[model samples]
Target: MNHQDHQDHQAVGASVDRVAKQVIDAGLKVHRALGPGLLESAYEHCLAHELGLRGLPVRRQVPMPVTYDGMELDAGYRLDLVVINFNARLFRDGVRRFAL
Candidate 1:
């Protein structure tokens, strides 16, 4: 591979790492501020607010519909938060993203 191509790949990887750290920091901040014993919605809302305060756009309760053979069964599988700049959608169940 060319040197320039390697450098570009390294830069992109670094950027992704930085974004991941930022997201984790934001989540920690939310946990610290709110503490425990709260519902998922509460945490989701706080995380969204925290990310927004950091000048990042956050999407909450995003509809995730499921489609079957010629039919659709959307059992209300909503994404808890879709934080921008990280290329991922953090769910109450787990973190989900496409080909990071």
Candidate 2:
């Protein structure tokens, strides 16, 4: 990669790290407030709420489609949550993405 592209990649990676930290902290706060007596769905909703309160955009229960030979298939993969931001992984241009 060129120097500019390398710098951009570094910036995106740093951003992902920072956002992940924020999300982790938010989830921890939720867990601390409400102990582990609830269902997974409860934790999921609360985490989303907490992140939203922090002004972060979050997508939940996102469908994951597998592609093969220009065909997209429903492979039963799903992301529990996706936090959208410049630091978040993007799959545009047929690129594989990392979790944030």
Using lDDT as the measure, which candidate wins? 2
Candidate 1 per-residue lDDT over residues 1-100, each given as its tens digit: 8999999879867875766777788888999989999998898988888888887778888887777897768988986777653433433333534342
RMSD of each: 5.5, 3.8
| Tens-digit per-residue lDDT, 1-100, candidate 2 | 9999999989877877777788889988999999988998999999999999998899889887999899999999887887874543544432335454
Name the 10 consecutive residues with the lowest summed lDDT in model 1. 91-100
Could you tell me every candidate's TM-score relative to the true structure? 0.67, 0.76
Q: Model 1: runs farther than 4 Å from truth?
A: 1-9, 67-73, 85-100
Question: Which residue pairs clash within candidate 2?
Answer: none
Superposed Cα RMSD, model 2: 3.8
Model 2 misplacement above 4 A? 68-70, 85-100
**lDDT scores in order:** 0.75, 0.81
Task: Assess candidate 1 and give its lDDT.
Answer: 0.75
